[model samples]
Target: MRVLVTGGAGFIGANFVHQTVRERPDVHVTVLDALTYAGDEASLSDVASAITFVRGDITDSPLVDRLVGEADVVIHFAAESHNDNSLSDPWPFVHTNVVGTFTLLEAVRRHGVRYHHISTDEVYGDLELDDPAKFTDQTPYNPSSPYSSTKASSDLLVRAWVRSFGVQGTISNCSNNYGPYQHVEKFIPRQITNLIDGVRPKLYGTGQNVRDWIHVEDHNTAVWAIVERGQIGRTYLIGADGEVDNKSVVETLLELMGQPADAYDLVSDRPGHDMRYAIDASTLRSELGWTPQYGSFRDGLAATIDWYRANEGWWRPRKDATEAKYATMGR
Candidate 1:
């Protein structure tokens, strides 16, 4: 099988590539990435010789057309994905998430290639902290941030393409992913790296905002299961049933790192911050026979801490700049 992965050098996409190369020797993988601020070529360093890398933007019609034309499947993961960054400048989010998705849809429609879109659970907006309900396939779209709005638009585009143009495609909205190669700008990595550097972890708001966490490998495993076994034109929610509040997550990190549970600072909260997000991935689980391997969030988190500790070389260069950006925002 030939697979063309957009944003393959980024954290989650890079992990997908590493896992694919290790498990699926018959598959030839090609990565198309813009090498933006969040995209790192070094993330794919270990499997450098195993896959082909193309440096290009997903919005380039000709490049996207050529790449999609040659592939049996195209997994779209390229986008401006940070909520903080999107809130600062929404143009990149609109251009990359909405326009780039349109570009890919057109290419896939023209070539009749199988396409899978990667999305986030944030598109359904936040659930009240006490709500037992979780986001399901039938959940209505209710995006909060510029980042998620664009993602929601992209998801709609994929659905329209499938119905109107008969494009072979599937979509998956995954929960918060934490694993190796994640950028330090994200929540889990920021706190983990801060503790490693003897800096206090910063908590936003009251630190009660809840997120459904999932290991990147588990999420990607579900992605592959959908590609291989799922019906076309369906959307799958990928999660591991790992739900943790911000404060508790920080406390766990502190405990694992041998710091006081309360060794953290409260900072300004982000604008329009959602209270919580949860996912009901029953469709992917029961229908596709997929289940998470990471049964314990703490165990997965501890492994992630170890990865960042051992890979300081990969994350150090970006640490100061990320923290500086956050500092200037008073977050």
Candidate 2:
């Protein structure tokens, strides 16, 4: 099978490429990525010999069209995904998340290619802190940030293309993913890296914002399940039922790293910070008979911390700049 993975150099996408190359010998993989700030080409270095890599933007219509035409399947993971970045400048998010998706949809529709869209549960805005409701595939989008709003726009575009143009595609909105190769600017990796450097971890607001977490490997596995088995024009919610607040996460990290639990500092929250997010992945679980491999969030987090520790070379280069940016934003 010929598989084209957009943003395959980025965090979750890179892990998906690694997993695909490691596990599926029969598939030929091609990666299309712009190598943005968050995207590290080195993430795919270990698997460099096995796949074709194209350093290009998804918003480039001709490139997207050509890549889509040659693929048996396309899994789009490209986007400007950081909520804080989106808040600082919404234009990039709108362009890449919305226009880029449109470009891919046009190409896939033209080529009759099987496609799967990777999205975020943040598109459903956030739930109340005490609310028990979880975001299902049926949940209406109520995006709270520029990043998520653009994602919501992209998801809607995919849905419209599926229904109106008969594009053979599926979409999955996943919860927060933490594992290897993740950019340091993201929440989990940032805290892990800070703790590693003997710097106190910083928390936004009161550290009470709840997020449903999943291992990136689990997320990619679920994506494959949906790609191979999901019905066309359908959407799936992917999660592992791992929900924890920011404070608990930091405390656990401190515990794992042998530091005092209260060593972290709390900073003022970013604008429009969502209170909570949770995903109800019952449809995916029941229909596909797929389950998350990471049974314990703490165990997964420990493993992630180990990755950052053992391979400082991979994340160290990106660390200072990311923290500098955050310092400017006071996040």
Best by lDDT: 1
Per-residue alpha-carbon lDDT of candidate 2 for residues 117-185, written as tens digits (9 for 90 to 100)? 999999999999888899988888899889999999999999999999999999999999999999999
The lDDT for every candidate, in the order shown, is: 0.96, 0.95
Clashes of 2: 0
Per-residue lDDT of 161-252 in model 1, one digit per residue for the tens? 99999999999999999999999999999999999999999999999999999999999999999999999999999999998999999999
Runs off by more than 4 Å, candidate 1: none
lDDT for 55 in candidate 1 is 99
